[model samples]
Target: MPRRLFIPIIFLTMLSACGGTPASSPSEVASPASTESQLEALATTSLLADIAQHVAGERVHIESILPVGADPHSYQYTPQDVAKVADAKLLILFDDTSYETFLEPLLLTAGGDTEFVFAGAGVGKRADLDLGGFDPHLWLDPNNIIRCVENIREGLTHLDPTGAAVFKSNADAYVAELQSLDAWIVEQVNQIPAERRLLVTNHESLGYFAERYGFTIVGSVLESFSSGASPSAQQMAALIDQIKSSGAPAIFLDAGDNPALAQQIADEMGIRVVADLHLESLTDGAPAGTYIDLMKYNVTQIVTALK
Candidate 1:
C-alpha cells in the first residue's frame, strides 16, 4: 500500500491488536475511538455537525469534516481525514453520491460495508441546476432539515440501537425546534415586501431558502453550484444584467468565499454585498454557533438589507 493508506491500516491493526487506539505522533490521525469497536462520531459539514449534535446529546462526539468557518463545497479530504473516517460507525453525508464529490475517496477508504447516511436523501427535491449535478443543499430550508433530522435519527439509532429512545426523543425535540424556526422565519420574512425578497447569492446556495421563504433567486455571482467553479465572462455579464433588472438589494456572500468578485459586482451595480451569512459553516460561538442561529442571522441580515 502507499504510505498514506499504509499508515492508517497499520494504525487500525494496532488498534485491534492492543484493543485500543494506540498513542501516536501528533502528526498522526488520532482515532476518536478509545476501543476498536467504539463509534467515532463524524459528520461531513460543520452545519450538519451542529444539527446532529442536538440529536446525539451525550452519546458521541460529533466532529465536522470541515473545520469551523471552512467552505465544504471546495473542501478536499487529506490523508489524515481518510484514516479518521476508517473508524467511523456512521458517516453522515450532506447528499447522495452526487454532491460532496470530495468524499468519494473517504468512502472508499472506509470500505464497502461501512454504514453511511445521506441527511438530504429523502428531501424529495433535486434540481439539475448544479453544473450537470443535483443541488444538494436541502438543509437551507428548515422544513427540509426536518427530513434531515429524521434521517440522522434513523442512522444513529441503527449504529447504537440501545440509544434508540434517546435519539428518538432528541430528534423529536429538535424537529419541533426546526418547526418553530420555520414559523419564526415566516413572520420575519413578512416584514420584507414580497417584491423585495430577492436573493443574489455568491453561488446557487439559496434555492431551497428561496423556495421555502417566498424569496426569488435573482442570480448568483458564481455561475455554478460549487463555489470551486468559476464564472465565465458571459456568465458574469448575465448575472449583472439579472441583478440590474431584478433590483436585488444585496449579493449575499457566504463568509468563507472570496469577496473580491462579489465586491466588484456590488460596486458596479451600486449595491452592497452582505458578506456575513454563515451559509456553509458555523462559528465558535455567537452570531452563528448553531444551525438555528445560522438561519436567524442570515434572515436578519437579509431583512435588514432588503426591507
Candidate 2:
C-alpha cells in the first residue's frame, strides 16, 4: 500500500480495536475552555510526558517540568517550576528519586495536595547495574514501558474516570505499536554479531536496554546510575582500560548530558562517541520527537556505531 493510504488504514484498525468507537485522534481532543476546568498533568521528564500524553489522549493537558534536552538527573527547579507542580491536578514521575534529586525538595514544598503516580512502581531492576537501588531507566525497554503504560492508564483513569475508555483505547493502540517496536529492535540488534554486542556508555543508563536486548554492558565512564555523580580519575582510567580490552566500538552518550567527559575518553581511546542517543529526553522536533521515534533513532545510532 502507498504510505498515504496506509496511514488511515492503520488508524481505522486502531478504531476497530477500540470496540468500533471512533477513537479521537490525539490532536482532535479539545482543550478545556477555562483554567479552572482544565485537566492539567505534569511529568518529570519529556520522555515521561510523551508516555502520559499517549494515555491522556486529549483528555488531559500534559506538561513536562524538564525543558527539552535538559539533564533530568541534575535539573534545577525554578520558582516557576514549583508553580507548574502546584497547578497540575496530577503529577506523573519515574519511580527512582535518586535520579531526580530535585523532586524531593520540590515535592515537599509544593506537591502536598497534588495527586501523583510512579510509572516504574513494580518494574524489576537489572541485577548487574543496581548501584544503590533499581535502575530508574526502565523506559529503555519496551517491556518495562508496557508496565508504565498500565500505571499511566490507571492513574489517568483514576484522576478522570469519564475518560477511562478513551485512555484504555489509546493505551491499547500505543502498546501494540510498542510491541512492534520491540520486535523491530530485536531484528536491528541482530545485525550486529553477538560477540560485538558490548556496550560502553557515559553512564549506566543502558542497563535495562542492554539486559532486555542481550547486549553486554562492559563498563561506563561514570560508575553511578545517576548522571549527577562525578567519576574519579581512577574510575575513568579503569573504564578506558575496559574499553580497550572489550573492544567496544562506541561510547553512547545522552544528548542531554555534558558529554565533555565522554568526548575526552573517546578522544583518548580513539573510539567513536555516539552522542546522538536520546536517553534522558526527546528531541525538540522530528527524527526523535516522539517516544517511538526516539527509540528507533537511538537504536539505529547504536547499530550504526557497533555494526
Q: After TM-score superposition, what is the CA distance of residue 167 in candidate 1 from its true location, in Å?
A: 0.9
Off by over 4 Å in 2: 1-38, 127-130
Overall local distance difference test of candidate 2: 0.80
Q: What is the C-alpha lDDT of each candidate?
A: 0.77, 0.80
Q: Each candidate's root-mean-square deviation in Å?
A: 7.1, 11.6
Assess the local accuracy of residue 155 in candidate 1 as a C-alpha lDDT between 0 and 100: 80
For residues 1-307, what per-residue lDDT tens digits would candidate 2 score against the true structure?
1111111100101112322232234543454445345587899999899998998988898899998888887888998887676555677887746667788777655543566677776777554333545466888998899988998888898789989999999999999999999999999999999989999987799989998899999888788777867889999888889999989888998876678998898998888898778988999997789899999999999999898
As a TM-score, model 1 comes out at 0.85
Q: Report how far residue 94 has shifted in candidate 1, in Å.
A: 1.6
Instruction: List, in order, the clash count of every candidate structure.
Output: 0, 0
Question: Each prediction's TM-score against the native?
Answer: 0.85, 0.85
Span of 10 residues, lowest total lDDT, candidate 2: 4-13
